[model samples]
Target: MLGTHRHLRGLVGGVAVVAAVAAGAAAHASAAPAPAANGAAAPAATTQKVLFDDTKAETAGNADWIISTSIPDPTKQNASPSKETDWTGALSAWGVALQKTGDYTLDTLGSGNTITYGTGGALDLKNFNTFVLDEPNNQLSAAEKTAVMQFVQNGGGLFLISDHKGSDRDNDGWDSPQVIQDLMSNNGVDNNDPFGVSDDDLDISSGTPTAINDSSDPVLNGSFGKVTSSEIDSGTTWTLHPSDNANAKGLLYTSGSSGNTGVFFATSTYGSGRVAFWGDSSPVDDGTGESGNTLYNGWNTDSNAALALNATAWLGGGSSGGGTGGTTAGSTTGTTSGTTSGTTSGTTSGTTGGTGGCTSGQLLTNPGFESGTSGWTATSGIINTATKEPAHTGSYKAWLDGYGKATTDTASQSVSIPSGCTTANASFWLHVDTAETSTSTAYDTLKVQVLNSSGTVLGTLATFSNLSHNTGYAQHTYSLAAYAGQTVTLKFTGVEDAQDQTSFVVDDTAVNVS
Candidate 1:
């Protein structure tokens, strides 16, 4: 797949579109507009880190996809002339946008730490809030898949990008389609929907694929800009199974030749994390390609640049336009059944239902673990009441990885949200002090998960790490408005490294509904 000259042959609408030829056309001279935030100053990007994966033999070149080399003219043109430096060519623009906005720090994974799951020799998802896999040429190892799935479940963002079928650039048994299919399937996303409908399939589409604007999707009508349309050269399409993943939403679609509509881009929430999938690599391609097959200008065309930024923002726990999981500090509007005539108070116990009934205050189950793990379920590791120094509230709080066992410990509780809850809030105090070394490579972490009835992780509410450098207990809150009328589970997990000890303490966990 290294610079394969195939888009011209795959032109749609019977029109021949070639990247090499397109670059030779009338060139537009322009620079990318300055990064803006709703006509205001763009926020500092220091907090978020975007990790690009080059471990799965992403392409033929080692530095080809590196963001540092991707510098393209903002004006319209064909393939970028800086192919060697801009290996991913226009695709580098995506990273450039994120970097320029100072919204995120872009990094890449090279030959070291091959992506593995539950292992110390691979990429540690804990270091990053989002992961980007663009056009991986090789199949992922079982550990890699596990790492990705669990990472998302534990509240990490993932961007799964793929090209058309037979895009086996390295002649590997896996393409993006097969790899993603397997990844999603193993993670409870079925290749087929219930009632025997095949919803998780991928195929190649011909011609210039029109980008479907789903206004409801934050990636489209996001804070960056309202994405109206985008162009695709030759790309593949993916189908989503919302019936299986309730948080799954199609953001971009293309009507193919055989009465088939292809999903160009889609977003879904898994456990507290967000996942987005795009079907083409050309959208980020510059003019660089292998040998004679160069790509066209995609980063500057349409809303591709904005799309990249918006996607990054959303995945990084921020939104372009108040989309799902926006990190902005404010109360979110959740879907409420009806207006409440009164304020409701809740208690500190009860697993299945709001047993204490509803009151006018926050609710929790032994918020301080003073009553032991009565309402919560401990699955693994040492998750019990601990009488240690620096208790945020009472004499005891929940302690995980307590014994320095080098394990993954978890404790969870189910809560029944009361009716007339127009909005809800879940807050907790966290304390972390660890002896683990290397913030990026270490596995010691504390993850907060949200689960549905079937115990399937719906979203990752939050993730805490010793890397945070918290001097003491800190208060963290998440909007539970998304779960206003439902019964959900809150899972607290502690993942420790094999060597040093990491202590994760939690107390004063509260859920408030109004």
Candidate 2:
């Protein structure tokens, strides 16, 4: 929104709210501890991975909708940033707020990359819990539209931001509204009013849209605090269609209107995913960004920051995808909530073996990586002391597929179970991070399987992603009694898509027979 429309409409107007609060301002510049979620701390290993889109001309003209100039990883800008100014971007305040909470991992889809999905691009939509496209200036390609839709359909959170019509800064014959419209109508996925909100052909000069009265809604009464209103500094509105999607509801409305006709902000769910739409990009404008550009701080005014952050939390953790909002550790999440921060627990059942008393001792060589790759055939560099990923126990562990590229890593060992043994259990401590999420697509995965002495598949035990959402290393136990009495190979295979690293670390393994 680089135009003079904001100036033409006067900037002195106040937005209505129940109270005077600035989650954005506090989140923007505060060095204090971040506001606690539900008055409790979040799990260390579980982080909401968010990807901000910058490849869609988000910075065209005065629009600097980026977390930081640093691509992919924002920490590189300032190893330990305490303020938004520490990072160079208009949305740094938002990024800094999430960082301080220690509950999120932020990334940016830099200019050189294209929006993609199954192609395995490290920045693929499948890898992130939430994707923010603020006031995009360019149109979406066929592939880009499909990638976005599939990302949502497969349980990803999508945040769509738009500006008033005729505000095409890129002069690409398409603005955010038109581009977003095309994405919903011509995607590779379903095209049946996907998000259930149609962009009205109107450029609202200004409006202070107030939030709806819904005490049960987490987006309004979230940990960030109660949200009362959102500003429309020269923005647009949307027409909601609950008929297409029952969950499609307007959250904020234009002045003097309460129905879905004058929706300033709206949210909905399609398939197994969740989505949010904002008519104007002004609320996110922190009024701070790169040099030589005029910006505004709409982010700090009214309840804009709370609205945005809470909505982000809702989108991210409100769904069963990679989101981190509205969810706590050890809690079971529904399709509407985020993934569980606690590690999943349960025994993966395999071929059944007889139950009996201990007859044979634990069988396996180099049970841990402390002895390196000895007695274990593995890919080069699979066993290392590098600290990029922490081991479950000792200084050594079997690290696999952290290359953030198309690759596979494996580690395996053979052992013979005594025929006298009637029961067996194979257990291991595994840690995972990155690309593996609870999405519709298994972009990254760790497969645990059993193979006969001849290298033929005996049975598949279990699979893990992103380390099973554990605090760090969670123990995984599987029943290997089915294979007792026969020589078998226990193998771990980690597969990653095109980009972004998904490290599956294995340490301290054992197979016991009774």
RMSD of each: 15.7, 19.1
CA lDDT of each prediction against the hidden true structure:
0.53, 0.67
* True-structure Cα RMSD, model 1: 15.7
Residues forming the 10-long window of minimal summed lDDT in candidate 2: 1-10
If scored against the real structure, what TM-score would every candidate get? Answer: 0.56, 0.56
lDDT at position 497, candidate 2: 76
* Residue-level lDDT tens digits of model 2 in 255-294: 9877769999888765335688999988888877899765
**Candidate 2 stretches greater than 4 Å from native:** 1-45, 318-514
Indicate which candidate wins on lDDT: 2
For 1-514, candidate 1 gives per-residue lDDT tens digits of 1111111111111111111111211121101112244321234434565678877666554214445432222112323323323333335556555555544555577644466422332234545557888877766665566557545543456888777776676665767667766666553221122111112334554444454534444566566776765666667776654334434555666754222236677766553456778777767765554443445667777777667677766675622111223332211212111111221122544333333344445566666665665677875323343334235655545666634446777878898767655446777766655655442333566777778899887665554554432335545566666576689998888886665666766666788765
In terms of lDDT, model 2 sits at: 0.67
